[model samples]
Target chain A: MDGTLGEAGEFGLIAELVKIFEGSVDGDEHVLVGPGDDAAVLRIKHGHVVVSTDLMVEGRHFRRDWASASDVGHRAAAQNLSDINAMGGTARHLTIGLAAPADLPVEWALDFARGFAEECKSVGATVVGGDITRADEIVIAVTVIGQCTQSPVLRSGAEAGDVLALVGRQGWAAGGLAVLGRGFRSPRALVEAYRRPEPPYAAGRQAAEAGATSLIDVSDGLLAEARHLAEASGVAIDVRRGAFEIPEPLTAVGAALGADPMQFILGGGDDHALLATFPDVASVPTGWQVVGEVLEGSGVTVDGLAYDGPTGWTHF
Target chain B: MDGTLGEAGEFGLIAELVKIFEGSVDGDEHVLVGPGDDAAVLRIKHGHVVVSTDLMVEGRHFRRDWASASDVGHRAAAQNLSDINAMGGTARHLTIGLAAPADLPVEWALDFARGFAEECKSVGATVVGGDITRADEIVIAVTVIGQCTQSPVLRSGAEAGDVLALVGRQGWAAGGLAVLGRGFRSPRALVEAYRRPEPPYAAGRQAAEAGATSLIDVSDGLLAEARHLAEASGVAIDVRRGAFEIPEPLTAVGAALGADPMQFILGGGDDHALLATFPDVASVPTGWQVVGEVLEGSGVTVDGLAYDGPTGWTHF
Candidate 1:
């Protein structure tokens, strides 16, 4: 009667999981050979396949008490999907590797799969394959496969004199994280934002069509990612602090906590906003806002000065 | 001067680790974009891309005390590569997801990376990209991308009257595991085999070239994999127990341990040998040994009798 891994056993639990994931496939035949096989065969739909993977661990990536198992699934999916989006590609298929304690409830796994599958489907992709096993703690890794609509964008494509821009959500997740870290849970919107920041899923393709040269997701704050773009492209980027204009929910939270909203805008990551550079600001599409400009130098400068703040997040 | 991850830091260690992985790429341009990017772009060259991922936890999948860090890397790569081999495809690129303790020595990671990269190169592939981070316990997941030369050989392809043969080494690794588990390490060959079983890397293509109807690697023991093939193909497999011919070191070790070598031959999984079905016995390839026959039924029987022994292995 115990609906845990110990009761279902490895193969039995996998059987149940296989049925759950099978229901979520796109049915568009992007996956030639689905799960329950030695390996999955993916049909290459576009010019090329864009693949990326990210791993989440308990205590390090997520606190189980702070978020539900479903939220953990969402967080894992968001990380990988955002990477594909950063590449200017449409996600097509995904394979997940999940290892959890034997005592983990089967119902929890089912919910996690649903949330994970929901995220993939939202991006117009399918959860083609995955592996679920037993471990000491929860270890979830999702590898996303995407199809490039045109030339896949790279981080090294930015040019000197290009107008650096921003698209989609920003800063709210970091504010939400700060609130949650300080043990406050009343602000449901901010709490939810930290759990799963809505990424601009289709904006990567939009930017690609708009002829944007360089692009990256704000997984590592604006300043840090700007530095990455600049360093990778071998050019400098100068940000006009006046452009960020700390948006809604975050502003209220910042005021309540007596924290600088500018610091959040400058250093808050996990918003998954598309930070890109275009040859001309006029061609940078509708959703994007110009924030900085590329130059023939190195590193990043905020308003012509090195804005000394914490750069971003790291694993170590 | 502390050699731990806390002292080395994530980016600083990644900077060192990048050089280790970068040296393993296939020089002939299969990798369009290497590590340090959000995602890796691999040039597709075949019918389709074959992908499989496996997650190994510290105590469940391996023992740190038994296998060195380099051996852990080798074991991880071999498991993934053999999966592609099982599908009759040539491996091209790999993206790794690793989460280790913060106090883990930087030297340990470097050695692990070298072994991982070496195994990748051995299979004519490259480590395209990877993510490394901190976790309570080390978790390693490798997703291997392969290009199929022809219609992939699937587990469902075996038909009645097909000759089930095995190519490459077998039974040794499982026997090795048992001996190692028993806390005796004198039998160096068996101990080494358990640590890093050299899979028949080239025989997968050879079997495909010889027109294999069905194929699978003996990762979950021969009988267990035989059952997998039979169940997937909707047929029965009658394994001939008389044929395995108990090889030298295994027989000696079996005698020493008061164990039957046949059990290891029948159910040992980690050998990574290719167990496959062919249309004609004569066409089972030069290196292959015929040990079973496919028939019109379900499940697997050893010499016309149901196998009462342990089927294979599972973490749970």
Candidate 2:
């Protein structure tokens, strides 16, 4: 049990991982056929099925030294589950495809499955099936299936004169990555944010129910997503710099690094905050901060002018 | 237009790949929302949803020099789609997550997507949504969403008095792999089988309708899958070696390499043949070759005795 994957073999490693996920499926009537088969079967009992996929590479998306297997698993589940939420759906099932080096510890794979199952359980979802393979570097691919109770929210539904709103944290992950870049992990909150982001999952459904015009997850910073929303909706978005009241953790991190916290808010990625546009300020849901406005033009601007800073990430 | 992924940027590469999938989604009404969104929405109009996932790495699952990008794509699609077919389901949608190095040619990625889409299109399925990331090596993960038209066939349903039947080729891929390993690739069919398996996709539904008691896709050779079905159902399978009429291609390859073609049929992997059991020999569907019988015992045997050879593949 304490040996590497090579020692345990593929089937042995999979048996260990399945034991972790099988515990999360108790009392779930929707699962017609669970793991240990060629495929998993589930009943979709709503309007439509919402599906999305994401990949997390070992060195590019995460680091073994910076994040544990559990942390990587949590982040992987969060990112894909947030996509379903972005579409105003409830996540029901997840299938993971993991490829790792043969020398990787069996404990790492088991802990990853535990973390993934725990995250799925938080939202009434289960890991139904997956494939494991050998590779030079670790790569985790997650596909999420969700059911929509209402019409899905789209990125192209925004209109001019709509109010722009934000929910959850945006700059924390950026700040944590910055801290990590400096080889300092003292700021526990910031470092944790970078390791495992907690997306505001319920906010997406709430936004859809509140008649939000457009919805998007703030994965690629606020300003970059605003630009995407603007282009997709064929309108412009203007952000007010005074809208953000920097959190204490970010402020402390900024002071320690002698860097402006606003840059992180405007350019950092992986926070998974919910960015939405509403018909008016009154239509914006409670706990959702009004940060900007939809306008007659193109592209995103700050206070009616362009704010010159980094916008987002490009994997290539 | 003809540059590496690094030159195209992530968005540019995604845009290029999206165009390939977009062509495959035309006139598919089940797709409420397709690619270019956070998630794709699909209408599931059947008994239940069947889902499966698979991962293919560059050096392990495939070789860039041995197989083209399109071949890899076809192989990835075939493996997952066959999983759905194994459950007597019709595939509806596919979501692919691809991670590759920045130096990878954009053409390679596009070709991969094209091949995947083409394979899916053959089964009336379309690519929905996916995430692309940068990694040190190429890793392709595919998840398929399918709908069951009837009750799904499970591996644990085979009875002791059932008759075993096999559909599709089992040893062609193994023969091709042996040829490739020895630096010989004259037999086009075998090499093609190794690069992209053609599973008898329609035979699964036919078997289910004909009252198949147990079903499995022979991904890891005939003996390996037979052993799996036997273990899952708590029954024993006895394969008659004389039942196999070794194909001419395999015979030629086996003769040239001074190896037994029977070994390929018994121990090869990646052919993706459909194996099922019926209550009696009379219930076996047309075109399915009866190869064995289920007995009241445990484990799989050849000629009622243990066959000493490679059973199947292990990733580790």
lDDT per residue for candidate 2 within A66-91, as digits (tens), equals: 88889888888998899898887889
Candidate 1 matches the true fold with a TM-score of 0.96
C-alpha RMSD for every candidate: 1.8, 1.1
Instruction: Tell me the TM-score for chain B of model 2.
Output: 0.98
Worst 10 residues of 2 chain A by lDDT: A18-27
In terms of docking quality, how is candidate 1 classified?
A: medium
The estimated TM-scores of all candidates read 0.96, 0.99
TM-score, prediction 2: 0.99
Per-residue lDDT for B1-316 in model 1, tens only? 2499879998888888789878886474867778887887777845888899889888878888888989988999999999899988888888898888888888878888888888888878888788888888888988988888687888999999899999878888988888888888857888888888899988888888899999999998899999999999999999999978888888888888888888898989988999999998988999899998999989999999998887788768
lDDT of 1 by residue, A181-201 (tens): 888884678788778879999
Clashing pairs in 2: none
> lDDT tens string, model 2, B1-316?
6999989999898888889999888889999999988899999976899999999888888888888989988999999899999998899899999999999999999999999999999999999988899998999999999999799999999999899999999899999999998988769999999998999999999999999999999988889999999999999999989999999999999899999999999988798999999999899998899999999999999999998988888889
